[model samples]
Target: MEQKRDDTARDAVPAFDWDPRSEEVQADQIAAYDAMRGRCPVALGAQGNWAVFGHADNRAILEDPRSFSNAVSAHLTVPNGMDPPEHGPYRAIVDKYYTPWRMHAFEPTCRRIAHRLVAGLARDTEVDAMAALAEPFANEVQCAFMGWPETLHGPLREWTRKNQAATLRLDRKAMSAIALEFDGYIREQLETRREARTSGAEPPMDATTELLGEQIDGRPLTDEEIVSIVRNWTVGELGTIAASVGILVRFLARHPDVQGDLRARRHDAGLLARASDEILRIDAPLIANRRRTTREVEVGGRIIPAGERVVVLWASANRDEAVFDHADEFRLDRNPADNLLYGEGIHACPGAPLARLELSVLLQELLGATASIEPAGEEPRRAAYPSGGWSTVGVRLA
Candidate 1:
């Protein structure tokens, strides 16, 4: 049944259920979201967006792409921001880059990076995992995967920090500037590749260069489209991947028994991968994705008007008690198809396979290399909205 609320009038604006930026929510999004899910399945947030907290509601919205449009932003976001017929071709192109063959080919490179990072950890000392390992692994692996040079790593890391800050503040001017800044970086790479190919020089055949060759509907993709696609990929790689690392580390440290179990089964690649997904499901890394309602709809007994913004709380939905036996408990045997870690429907994350490979490999290396990973004396700081996981995760590796 729809929870009690007097704002069922056709055009009436629903009262705000929670302040997204309040101290309570910002301090601990997981706990705050879980509480909100129980009280208000479909809530109107202080930011004028409808926050859908129930697993069923979130799933319904995701599956019905026609009603909940992905075109929430004024700017182009490649396939992610496109819908239906428009989203298909680009999505197909993106999917090719993450095929089984591609992931298999990239596994060795991923492992070498993971091995080196784990090897460098200072044993028995408190190290800020975000700084010491998580951020660096995210940066290096993304660069390596994209075939970007080492010099771009520092710039990309700094750019991610600035982008997250601007997003949290809802600074439009800063966001636009940041977008342009990223565009410049990607455009430079494209131009350099174009020049290399033009001069008959051997250009590095990386994802960026390969994208230059992709044709959509018998036409070459525009620079705007290419840049947008690369921007999205980079954001997922650098931001979400890093966040997943911290969340995984924090979970393992807090649950030593689970950690030991994982360490014991580190050789079983399939188990390791499933275990990573389970851990991430318990503490989502990507947070929510946005959509706009095309027409008035009732979600979880709440009337949402036409053209309204909806935020599907992935961080909350994945942990819904109604869906999972024990929402907060990590169980590898749980159904993988039910987990929305990479989301669902056509808009599901295309980069999921690569993310799984990266996280799984890193966990294996970290667990195999160290005898134990425990919490440090320092408290970890949680990342604010628009980012999930810790901003600083201090752990002692022994």
Candidate 2:
């Protein structure tokens, strides 16, 4: 369905194209969002999609699942891709896995992983934080959560990178090949778990078990559904967590005052958590989330027709001046209002608590062990998609 335009409205929203991979491209994307916010809070884009750039407008869209749906696919993000009523029960199956209590139980293991990763960097004066520490740290924690063999970490990381590349590829054959490879990987894991169950050994407490045990609408989920959910988790969690760590470290390095304050307040996990939120606001891992309009609706005074795809620019919304004062600067003192980094509404990320726990422990371990972190010789590389950050961030440990 195409979006309908109101001829009576005088102001015409400008069209903007974006390529998120290049720093120049990203800067331009931000500029475009800022420009749209200045003119109209919500505007129509060149792709015939509605774009909500202002903080308030973005929040409204996120909070109203009835107005917008989360079922975007080929990008099946469990629960992340399901709408309410239908989405609620499926989400509940794994919701408890990320609660504060559950996170607390996982803390010791998280801390251990962080300590080991940071300690490994101690031997090297400078290391690529993304590859040497962040990626491995996220991978190990994910492995711990899924109860999968640790050997899968390397392949998992590789698969995530390939999946991102596949999304950007113009060739259908390339994309299909990547999808086939990942499907095979998931099938292998499922077979391994089934064998364990047959042998009467204790089945692992990982995502596979949790997913296998889950019943949607009182019937067990099919293997295809399980694979879809796990694939989303694997693809979404690993790279983003690794990228976020790099962003946080890079921000601290550039802002010594903030770094010093964080280090001084090391004992306060709450403060550390707030600091993480502020960092996320400053440099979001994902630029936007794609959602398709289900029915004709009005947003920001513009009428959006059904079936048109919309890209909610989360990074722009996080920094919108309407909701955040001094929105451009990183201010830890700012009240961390619900930022849409983990998304919102019925599609709000179920893994948020776990991600938060991993990040907090990583920061705590790094601050406690190292005096300071500085950029090494390597230049930072951003991810191919609009939804990711640094591919490599080298840091010199002090």
Candidate 3:
């Protein structure tokens, strides 16, 4: 029962069922994605890539890595942009960096960063969650995690914005420039370490310095390789982390009961973490991930040819009515395994442990610091495509 479409559909490609960057979608992404999921789960985009919005389709795509490859990027992305046989080995290198022991070791520093940000928020006043809270917390934590200097905080924030703009424009030149700009920052740290080692002086023992000693296939990781790896980690840590903060803060503001419940049990780390996942599941922070088809596939009654592009819309899939009965309701009792907050299959997020820890700690601090969190005067502004969650959420803390 595949939906019939002529070769012209293939020729035009992204016959885009809907514009991801449209003013309508940008105005209310969740509603737009939800409507698409219900009406047309699988559709070709304007660029010819099939947009998969249903939960079942996304799960099947994620599970069948053989048919859906992760090598969607032209640039090197360490483990994230590689496919199996190659993916597993590089993934091993990335996994060693996020072990429970590492997260435990980093918790104190992570909490200090979270606390400093939360404590700085003025009480009973209107504050832009993205500017005064979310962005700074994400930036400082990432810098701390990478063992980068505090001087990098401002540049990295600006870099995230430029990277997002470049991505939205699909401007390879701007993308390349921003990427090199990022590389220069990373390379500066690497050079400092090299100089310290040459002078027989000890360098700072941090993640960046530790990465210098890592080897893949029995050879030390090259500067280019290390930069690529760090770049991937930085993007994951900074961009999504900021989005998650804004989303979480706004969610709490909108739902006072949920906020009050969590505030009462603020000491319960496990409950708070699960709540974070549920909140994110209802409103995704990272919208979509791209994949390339290895073979022809039939999904959601549509015929997709081989060598085509695919976009898995997490914001829609997680809220698919088929899976979550109410879809939008925040329920703490829902099964955690079913949630795709960290993705699925071999390419699942390796930094999830660290992310969970950061989120749990941040929520705990916010609840403890403020008596309540509620919406401020202006309506929360949704972020544009390529980014999910609120761009500017005004919240009043008391």
The candidate maximizing lDDT is 1
What local lDDT does model 3 show for residue 373?
96
lDDT of 3 at 281: 99
Best-to-worst ranking by lDDT? 1, 3, 2
Location of the lowest summed lDDT over 10 successive residues in candidate 1: 1-10
How well does candidate 3 match the true structure in TM-score terms?
A: 0.95
Per-prediction TM-score: 0.95, 0.88, 0.95
Clashes of each: 0, 1, 7
| Deviation in Å, model 3, residue 271 alpha carbon | 1.0
Model 3, 246: alpha-carbon shift in Å? 0.5
For model 1, the superposed segments whose C-alpha errors exceed 4 Å read 1-14
Candidate 1 TM-score to native: 0.95
Residue 157 displacement (Å), model 3: 1.2
Full-model lDDT for every candidate: 0.91, 0.76, 0.90
- Can you give the lDDT of residue 361 in candidate 2? 86
TM-score, prediction 2: 0.88
Give the per-residue lDDT of model 1 (tens digit) for 1-398.
24344435534663588888889899999999999999988989898999999999999999999999999989999999999989999999999999999999999999999999999989988988888899999999988889889899899889988999999899999999998998999999999998998899978988998999899999999999999999899878899999999999999999999999999989988788899899999998988999999999999998999999999999999999888888888887788888998999999999999999999999999999999999996787689997899988889999
For model 3 the local lDDT of residue 351 reads: 89
